[model samples]
Target chain A: MHWKEDSAEEGDLLRNALAGCEKAWADLFRMHYHRVYAFAFRSGLSAEDAEDAAQEVFVKAARYLETFKGDSAFKNWLYGIAHHAVMDLLRKRGRREVLLERLHENDTTSKCSAAAKHTEVGDVLGQLPDDLRMAVVLIYYEGKTHKEASKIMDCAETTVSWRIYIAKKRLRKLLEKRG
Target chain B: MKDDPIEKYLVKLEVPTPQQEAVERALHRSTLAFKNRVEPKITQRENTVFKWFEKYYLAVAFAIVFAAFASFFPWAERVCPAASETSDLLAIYSEVKMLFQNNLVAVLLQGSELKVQLGVPRNVAGARVMFVEFSRGDEKIKVLCLEGSALRVPLQGKVQPVLEAMPTADGGVILMGDSFVWSRAMPQTINGYNISARLL
Candidate 1:
């Protein structure tokens, strides 16, 4: 169901969720699952890794439900969680040089057609700064407008636009450097 | 050959579409994960006071009124006492949360969030009636003010000592202090209209 934080507020949700409403928590999960999952995938996770990361995001969301302010859209909150989960995954995959080289290869693949794009683009998405990568994914890949992207990003529209611009510039520079 | 291969190359590059299906699956799985991680607590008929009614109501009100005149300072729940019957409390909580989500009260009140916990009736040695504690997030002021008088909640179940509440409007705040400061005008519903309470 659509989330109306005012219905129970963040504090109440936490209290009730803490009380163990499997259904309510489930509803909460459905509300922002996709936003977070795509965030993890676009941030450079494999399909499998993205799935795992999504789980991690929810675990954290459940644990920290009490603190959630609902001040921003739930999408932004989930994305924030996804950002951390992806970062954790990236750090765990500490073969930076090897990974970078693979991503570079993948970058080359994106240069071609969209095929093999999954393995290739997925790797580099995590390589960009969380702020920039999120904007790029939300805008170009996810097909969200700057305003909607801003709602999800919980930042000003200008910030979303700037991130998109900078990410494109950076990706272009990286691709060019690879060549 | 005609133009810079770099700019020419860059212009034609295409960013791949994320698997919307992956997002969908992730959402579903995420919901499950949330449910799994949410280890539900067993609720019992608790008999603690909500923050609105405290024994020190006189001092609290004095302080609050004094503060309102001065700084308008206000204060606080009994600790989170779960319902005695684990299974029953969980059912009640689910129902209450659902009702709260669908209620018109939410739309009317902006930033008016509900805090719910299960309580047992006061003065009942072991009443099975479950009191669904509902309060607004903005009642911090009243809590601080009425910290003295333990407000009698309308719900039948025994009250728990502490229930985590936010700072909202008069969303039916109950005092958990030792004393009380409320007189029942009539039997009215607290935050969760599905539940009924006796105002003391």
Candidate 2:
């Protein structure tokens, strides 16, 4: 479901959670956990790393709850935090080079199994630069609009469009070379 | 418009789903963290105070150093011998510092008219005092004034001589310095022996 449709319910859950309601906290966590996990994964983290990133995002959100000004949707604010958390995880692991090497290796191998295809796609995404990767992940994989993705990425909406343009061009070249 | 080939390809590609047990584990850990959340209002207040300190620490340090230097070797003492009466001069300097601290200097400087008065206390013989009053809009402030004779004292300290004292036609003197001017005149007595004094 779109975040807008559930925004009022989510806001109530967030308010209750902040008010120390355990059930509300559980409900809020269950609501966004998968999406945040998927965001982390699509942002070039491994499954385990994504889980760690998601956990860190929620912890940080709780810790800095007062900083949430309600200027933006809660989901976008959460995604902004998620963006930083995922980037920090990736930087800490120094996984870009490894992912690139895996991408090159997978390009030469047969695209047979579903698991292999999944890893190949992730590796291909990881091969893109961090900014371009984020643009693609937020706009394409996560189905965020340019405006919403700009909020998540903390950049101008035009910058988001430009980054997506560059990312798609790069991805096209990479895929064509692989074929 | 038809979907781009790349978009079609990416959309069709199945991303791996997170394992159910892993999601449960993350939820458990996150909920525990959420339950034990720190009080954000306290954290935000502390952060604001720290930010304020970070921004003004240098200015605050300089103000401290200036205050210490001014107290030890006051500007009044360097300009005039009568100002060597450090106790009285320092008291006036302390008053000036209070005015500065309370952001009253601007108001005093920009006051509409300058009124000067001189009086001697009934009990204190040979001790003359001057009152300088300033009015800004409806606000009135009166500051203790020092004599031009005080500024005529020979320079004795390493401090640069900056004060200019101009005597007025009516036996009043105007003492001009870097940022302020103080005007004073001879004592004015109301009754033959009863000279009322107003101390700030």
The candidate that wins on DockQ is 2
Writing each residue's lDDT as its tens digit, candidate 2 over B1-200 gives 12787776565445456677777777777777776777654455588888889899999999999888887876635676544544563465456646454222211221454322222212323323343333434544434433331221112234332333444566554555555454544433111211111222
- Worst 10-residue lDDT window, candidate 2 chain B: B189-198
| Share of the reference A-B contacts seen in candidate 2 | 0.42
Q: What is the TM-score of chain B in candidate 2?
A: 0.27
**Which lDDT tens digits does candidate 1 get at residues A22-119?**
66676666655655665665665544566678778887787666455556555556666776777778667653543564456565645325535444
Q: What global local distance difference test value does model 1 have?
A: 0.51
Model 1 per-residue lDDT at B168 = 18
Write down the TM-score for model 1. 0.37
Per-model TM-score on C-alpha atoms:
0.37, 0.58
